[model samples]
Target: MSKTSTPGQIRRLTKAHKMSFAAVATIGAAALAATLVPAGTADAGTTVAAAPVAWTQAVEGVQAKTVQHLSMQSKLATDAAKLEAAVKAKAAAAAAKAKADAEAAAKAKKDREAKAAASRSTVRKPVYANNLDGWIKESLAIMKAHKIPGTYNGLYKNIMRESSGNPRAINNWDINAQNGVPSKGLLQVIKPTFLAYHVPGTPLDQYHPVANIVAAANYAADRYGSIDNVNSAY
Candidate 1:
């Protein structure tokens, strides 16, 4: 005949994980109070050294296995998180360095272009003052371009003797003046000679210092070879 199962068997089943220990233990006590088993049957093989020992050992084994599984999972999760953080940190550092390098190259290019622009933008044309000295120098520069030969001293001496550095000086008693076109300007040239020999690019006005001097010098160069050779009136 079949009999109701005892607490010993339930404990053994709970230890082996066949069923939940909480559910089996709760119903085991009630079954024990209400059911009948032979007197010797319930505690007959129920010594502490019997199935209880095996049950305790089996439960401890399951707890050890559970703890091992949880520990392994925790370690794997921690390692993965650390590896991800390290990869992100390394990538961030590389990006920062690349940005710095790009900025430095851009600044260097700008500085080079600025320096080159400064070098290329320098003005080289000569600036002249508005005076007799400046005029003489200006005329000489113009003369050199036309290959005319004359010196500063040669021109200055003739100017002082002829008109005393006056641009509006006129001779009313001279033969050239008696004809109606008076000798005028720093070198005292009449209208006919001024117009004939006035250097190109200079003004046509006779009283203009550079025009008068340049015209007189041209006339002198034609007759005497150069103004520098004509120390006296030409």
Candidate 2:
């Protein structure tokens, strides 16, 4: 309602008042002067001051800008939180997989070592004493492996009768010795019989107790069903 206001100036001021404070800069200084003074009245004794913005419009504009800024901040915070959660989940999954893989490798190595130990135990030879009982027991075990049937009592009885449990016993006056092959060892098995019926793991020497007993047992089982059946000069 300024007395110097032109219709165009009034329109621009009206538009500026409806907008924010920044919108006032769009109108030129001529429009501002026209709004403050009457047309062609510049020489009159009147004070020139800046235009006052409407308080309600200015407050409303500030409130709307504040709401927009808060909304943008909220959206950015939500996005950042989601990204952080995803990164943590990925890292946790990788750690779990690494732990599982390490455990599996450790278990696999333990199993391999166990299997190798078992194999070595299986392949290692059993030790036996150098006595009548040990030789008989070991020979019986060998006979069982070769499907040759005999008993501890039967082997002991035969060994006692043949060589009195002497591992180095040899019959020089026997028919076998006359033919240039002496009956030797605990069961008095000749060289031909000893070589032919010798179990693979025992020594080839007829003086070896277990070897001699195993050879004699093998021969006896083949000929008389078992060494247990041999009671006399077999």
Candidate 3:
């Protein structure tokens, strides 16, 4: 025995099958859209990925700024060091110049002192003895040269008796002095007598030892014959 279906029941079953197929097609379309689009551009509110060229340029800008800062710091340090070195060198040079000037001044002072000492030494004079014995000895030499005849003993005795060997002796209380003819020198010879018989080679000063002795000897020779003949003051 074969079974037969009614048209209304068959139509209702076909309609349910078509609805299930339409739901499967909607799911397939959503999956295909997800596969084709990028994840960065998936939604309107999502941020976009940066391009490779833009990222590289930002990194290079940061590096350049850092290098510039470092270079400026290095230049400042070098300049400071150079300034300090220059100041020290200038101070050292000033000290050296001051020392040189001081040494030159000291040398100049020393030279001046040496020259003054030499000048002083050059102008010094010699000293001679001023005594009776020295005067008598000098007179004797002059008398010998002038050919005046008198012995050392005769001259010494007369000088001792007349003025006690004082070359500057004056006989102000004597007979010759009373007559306005004062006797002077070692032998107490009057000025008139000394001038009358003044020796050519002797000093004209009556107080001089050589002049007195020679003049007195010449006068005694002419008046009393010789100095040896006189035993006391004439």
Candidate 4:
């Protein structure tokens, strides 16, 4: 039998057909877009644009790290250079101080040696005198050094008898004078006799009281054992 559709049923059937058609149209539009564009071409534009930014950020991070490392290396090099310079400066100062100390020590040693040499030189010199008694004492000291035995009493007695204590006495009329060699001085020693018995440290001039006494005493000690042995004029 043929049946007629009610109005509510006809409306519901038309709504279902319309909804199906819209869904099919949307699927066909998506299919057509996929056919027109390449497989990954649609997202490639976005990826290409974002890739540069990401690469730039990564490079910038690497550059920052490299720059930081370079800065640290530069600081370390500077610190190392400063330390080396400080060590060199300290070594130089120590060397300079050692050199100065060595020089000072050498100077001190030289000064001490010079002073010691001066002292040694001073110790060897004999005392000087300029009088009869001073000459006698000086002669006595020299005689003591030479081990020649004589006393002041013997010397005075002999000098008084020989020339009456005259330091410049001359015997021009004696046998020695006739031979042109006059006995002279306190002990009346001839030039030959005085020169023969001249003692070291005594004056060369026989007229000198000390020179006369020392020569006479030397002669008497050599010929008669000692000046002290001659109690009278010798």
Candidate 5:
């Protein structure tokens, strides 16, 4: 004979299966919660996922302004570098010009000095011995009467060498010639030298020959080393 299935037995078995299914669903829910939430935090006070904040036209405009500002700063920096390079180039050119000018001036000064030195070395002093022979003889006689040192021959040699015995000898052409300041007589006597060295009661005319020769000899003996070297070519 076939056995009949009972509803109470079947209902008991279904209830046990339902409990096992509920236990499995609870475990899966716990694993998913752990993956979503931070450790040590209760789900009752947990943060919910928020939606991203929307951007406005004003915000986008700020970003565009920042990009423009960076571009402007880059251009300004490049301009500053160019300006500095130009300034450096200008300074270098100015320095080079100054150096060249200084060198040119120095060369010109040196050349002028050299030319002057050469001129001084080659020029000769004036000589006038040929015309004053008679005047010299008379002057020598007067020097003897006064008892001045040295023979007539020695005096003649000295005077000839000194001024070439020229009565009107003048070394300075520029002043004496222009002003007509006569260096009169065989001794080349200026007015001052004549007054200072004049023989007493002698005529002030330096051309008197006798007076001038004595005065010249006195001046030469006093100022120069001697009549000997005065006659020699310097």
Candidate 6:
């Protein structure tokens, strides 16, 4: 006759089967619990499945990080471009100011130089010790006494060209050449001419520039056609 198992044995076997099922479920939920077959019946089994995975949270985090990085990079690029443009504009403005300043300085310098030159030309000239009026008066008296033709201008020009109006003009060697004799004074009046034509108040030695010039005027008028022609060496 079939005997019933003790309670402890039956309890132990049930406990073991529960532990095995728990272990199997932990490893893979797809594994199914096996059923005990009775007399001639076939054994049947069932399986448990694992839960589905969710991807929404992880994918959103990655996308958000990527967008933040792109935004930061875009801002940096824009700021860099703006900074470069500002620098270039500042440099151009500085260059323009420098050029303007240089041009203004140059113009001012040129104007100053021109003004100085004009002042010098207008306000400066040499002064003579002997006044021009006195020389003219003395020259006129000589011309009248000598009976020389032409205006006093001729006498003035001749005297200036000959000795620059130096009254001490002399040619002692005129004695040797006989071309001129002891011709002294401004006009270089020869000794013979001075003696013959000496004026009443004038001495024979009145070979002074004024005296000589008067005597030369009369001699030039008698010999040469005119004072102008004499000046031309005729």
lDDT of all the models against the reference?
Answer: 0.84, 0.88, 0.82, 0.83, 0.68, 0.65
| Residue ranges of candidate 4 with Cα displaced over 4 Å | 1-54, 57-61, 95-128
Under the 3 Å rule for N, CA and C atoms, how many clashes does model 1 have? 0
Where's the lowest-lDDT run of ten residues in candidate 6? 30-39
State the local distance difference test value for candidate 6. 0.65
Clash totals, every prediction:
0, 2, 0, 0, 2, 2
Clashes of 2: 2
Q: What TM-score does prediction 1 earn?
A: 0.49
Clashing residue pairs in candidate 6, if any?
29-48, 32-46
Candidate with more favorable, higher lDDT: 1 or 6? 1
Question: What are the C-alpha RMSDs, in order, of all predicted structures?
Answer: 13.8, 13.4, 15.9, 9.9, 16.9, 18.0
Q: Of 1 and 5, which scores higher on lDDT?
A: 1
Q: What TM-score does each of the candidates earn?
A: 0.49, 0.54, 0.43, 0.62, 0.34, 0.37
Which residue pairs overlap in candidate 4's backbone?
none
For 35-64, candidate 3 gives per-residue lDDT tens digits of: 656766768665444445566799899999
Instruction: Using TM-score, give the best candidate's number.
Output: 4
Query: Per-residue lDDT for 1-234 in model 5, tens only?
Result: 898779998999899999999999999877665665556665676665422234456678889999999999999999999999999999999999999999999999999999999888885634434445655565555555665444466567756654676656665563554576656665566767777877664567776666777777666656663333355422
Model 6, stretches more than 4 Å misplaced? 1-133, 145-147, 173-180, 232-234
Ranking by lDDT: 2, 1, 4, 3, 5, 6
| Candidate with more favorable, higher TM-score: 4 or 6 | 4
Task: Please give the lDDT score at residue 38 for candidate 4.
Answer: 50
Cα lDDT for residue 89, candidate 1: 100
